[model samples]
Target: MESSSELADIKMVLAALMQGMNDTKGKAQVVEPKQEKPSAESEGVEGEEDVDIVQHETNAEEDKGDEGGLATYMKMHQDFYASLHYTRVQEMCKQKNIQYFRKDMGAWELARLDLQEYKDMLKGGKP
Candidate 1:
């Protein structure tokens, strides 16, 4: 039961609303590129400066990721292998009558050694 004039007014309001929504959407898109978001996807490399910045960001992310337990485990494995004092452990094992198993050492071997004893061994403590 609406009049023709009322129908025209409704159409105009709807058109204005649609145009406003489009304008807001366009402005949002224009504003968004002011802050960059990093993605793991392939990036468009323009030149060295951009490339270095991207790489630095990526590396920072990697360092953050490396704070997880897997990184700790990996570091422990490396240290245990690299800095393990085998001869000291063997002598300490002998002194303490601990079981000795060579070539079957790693995580278990590191875990079995006491903290004090390990530190002592690191300091080249005599059995």
Candidate 2:
């Protein structure tokens, strides 16, 4: 008898929940965002399909022959220089007049110093 009463209470609670859900259905408010007007430039002149215009600027020095090639060559062979022995790297730095303190730097440091000095030279900095 008590179990039947508990089952009836459970059914009543479920029915109330279902009725609440049904009442709220199809009554939800949806908000749409307002769109902004396009500017005259963005709309473009009549008869032209809307297209984005971009401007590209090239570096003057990058077009020069030997100087441009130097940057490219160093970039291409960075790994080769880094792989050389400390003594060889130091010798190359000396030959190229790349300023680096060999007493405190290892092979990798020496290689990077050489590359950086070359880059600076290309930029018209100290040789």
The candidate scoring highest on lDDT is 2
lDDT (C-alpha, whole model) for all candidates: 0.58, 0.67
Global fold similarity of model 2 (TM-score): 0.25
> Which residue pairs show backbone clashes in model 1?
none
Candidate 1 residues lying further than 4 Å off, grouped into runs, are 1-51, 57-70, 92-98, 103-108, 111-127
lDDT of 1 by residue, 35-104 (tens): 5765545355433353343543346777778653445665565466436577765665567666778623
Candidate 2 lDDT, 50-113, residue by residue in tens: 5657557667766775464765665455667656666776787777666656523444454466
Q: lDDT score, residue 23, model 1?
A: 62
Prediction 1 TM-score vs. true:
0.26
RMSD of 1: 17.5
Clash counts per candidate, in order, are: 0, 0
